[model samples]
Target: MNPKISDSIPQEDKDFDKQHIWHPYSSMSKPLPCYHVKSASGVRLYLDSGQSLIDGMSSWWCAIHGYNHQELNDALVKQVNLMSHVMFGGITHDPAIQLCRHLVELTNPKLECVFLCDSGSVSVEVALKQAIQYWDSKRQPEKKKFLSIKRGYHGDTFGAMFVSDPENSMHSIYTSYGPDNIFAEAPQIGFDDEWNEADIEDFKRKIEKHHKIIAAVILEPILQGAGGMRMYNPQYLKRVRELCDKYDVLLVLDEIATGFGRTGKLFAQEHANICPDIMCVGKAITGGYLTLAAVISTRSVANVISGGRTGCFMHGPTFMGNPAACAVSVKNLEILRTGAWKSQVDTIEKILLKKFKPLMESGHRKIRQIRVLGAVGVIEMKNPIDVALYQRRFVELGVWVRPFGKLLYIMPPYIISEDDLNHLVYSLISVATDESLA
Candidate 1:
């Protein structure tokens, strides 16, 4: 442990933060110690108090290349010197255009146009609007409903909350609206003994039943992030793609958490050789620098939303195409293109699997399932109580691992070294073995 940052922060600074700061996802009434970060590089976060913590969750799985990489910072600095902010509604800029070109090249060739937003949740909102409007343009306005897999998480925005599984998170407010636009199933990851041929047939039946009214089928591709890091077989995704096509439903792949090499591929859909009609990506798009999100779609889908005289996608944020953010995103993509991070991701996955296999085989009554995808790994505990205890133990051991209900998972920064990864795994095992958590 180290001295609190408040001890060193100027009295004025502390007063300002205390009076005005209200952080996202935090209970302001019961505040945690605020560690004022001095600087960060690689996978380490340095605090003003002189203590460092390995960013076990990549600052909520956004820092794909760790933090404060010189290349990314230089790109942002260069762009800021030229132009800082601009309304992307009527004007265009080099950074945004270049980033679009690069991202298109990196993604599947089928995806031709990219709509910029400021966050993953907003990108998903854009996708939902586009999908619904596409149906309206095609003279099928009745196709307004969206189907998402059970336990699949999209985001916290109203539109995203409606499409996500209701039981998983704090969605009571959205449900209160009695929105008829979204539908979902309990996640079927092909891991449970209960998952049999009947379950597959039932899922297909559900899709078929809703096919006429469904504008899109939204999912997290390979792994459901907030749905407890639950992973499903690629075959399931292939089937989903096929079913969506067969039913004339657009496939919306929310790669917000799984994108930018987090899943060992540039995109998660590549594992199944499937391309979605609409793709929502964010988190690491700017390498954890500026907030940026993109909604990419095929030319066919873009054309539907592109009205020559009257039709237009009437949605965008003020910071949608901020040049500085785009510049950082371009550099981040360049680093990913070099394939330098491939072996690093592979090493992490190997370490995770090697370390977690024993826990799975240990026949621990508390563990329900273990899942791994690329550099991501998860251990689904038997219940929520155990998950909470596991998370607390992890944070106490100098690693921060948040559990989603019963699902304890890690989506660490790709830049983490072997030693740090080993320490993380040891911490997890230690916590898992504790009867307190079990």
Candidate 2:
């Protein structure tokens, strides 16, 4: 079929995209019209149509410092000029080394090593493989099963999807596979209440049932992104840590969306005063300048993975530890260390809560629940249609707010000013309370 051409693009460009492009998480037969962003800076995206939109979701929760920051741009430019790419398997680069040092210092004391990958899904896959190998090298080959929480969203790769909640967006075809290697349950934490003893007992039961063969317990930390923006209790995390310790199972925390000051801290585990055996970090690691993710671990996990004759991790992406991405990450970390970004996030959270509190308490039937953590906030609508409608309406209202199933949420760039944040909250309130959505 000939490609459809938009007037905004040159006919050749349109044809080229239609002939060669297969977009991710999209239906090719009936694709959503693509946006041509001319440029972006601060918290706004300027489209080819000449309309400006607030990046309410931080371009999929990654743009921590916002778009087109001078420092990040300069870093990428400087690195590209010096060394654009290099194989990380044997060669070492300043960007990767410096970023790792910063990350080790920023994360828990136990997490001391970093393994670079291209994206969050790949990081999850790497961590899973590392855990399996850790057990195998330790002579516990039977430990292969992974226990995750129900409705948890990891990423799109096969291994990542295997560990995520099977009922989510990507697992329909794998129904026959069933729940043998993967174990899951409804999240124990909720916005309305904290984790209780019963919740802890149920988690313990699940752990005991699978403890013999379980290799690891994977979670999305305090908030489960792509799972209806569900918020869980940190106490549950503490309990999960204890259970993993007792059962000798590794704990893998997927902080791809929560890391780098997004959760009002350097990492979400800080809330519980606990640390995971392994952590998957992405998104804002490079401040959205380039694709990068890291599988960070303790000396113990590193030792196990490195001890084998295979000589450390069996995984490698061509772009792994790309100098350009790492250089950007080093600069991103420098920006975060300034401490001003976190203070801005805290202020934005306070303003958002104050503006949305009434809508949350209004008992609007279409709104099921409200959850806020650090700079991120979510509103669960009554249905999927409601979610789609709100997303579209919010876009028209000059804000880019994507809805996940029945959940509508915002994770604006930390640099957003109070005025922009207030606008976002009001727009969200309007959509949440609109009777037409019901």
The numbered model that scores best in lDDT is: 2
Local distance difference test, each candidate: 0.80, 0.83
Clashes of 2: 0
Error of 2 at 367 (Å): 0.9
lDDT of 1 by residue, 1-438 (tens): 323553677889977776678865545665444557788888877766666667778888788798888998899899999988889988999999999999899999999999999999999999999998898888888898888777777888888998888765667557777466545455466432333444446558778998889999888987778766777666777788888888889999999998888877778888789999999999989999988999999999989878522388778798888899999999999998899878878888899989898887875877778777788888777777444345446655767666656666777888888899988888866765567654
Give the per-residue lDDT digits (tens) of candidate 2, residues 1-438. Answer: 211223477778766666678765555665544556788999998876677788898889889899999999999999999999999877898888999999999899999989999999999999999999988888888998898888788898888888887766567687566445555566554744745767667668888888889999998888888866777777888889999999899999999988888777778888888999999999999898889999999999999878865667788899899999999999999989988887888998898788878877776878777878889888777777544455568867788777656777899999998889988988887877777765
Error of 2 at 88 (Å): 1.0
Badly placed stretches (over 4 Å) of model 1 are 1-6, 10-20, 32-34, 182-184, 190-197, 385-396, 436-438
Candidate 2, residue 212: Cα displacement in angstroms equals 1.7
What's the true lDDT of residue 189 in model 2?
A: 47
> Worst 10-residue stretch by lDDT in candidate 2?
1-10
Which pairs, if any, clash in model 1? 150-185, 150-187
RMSD of 2: 3.3
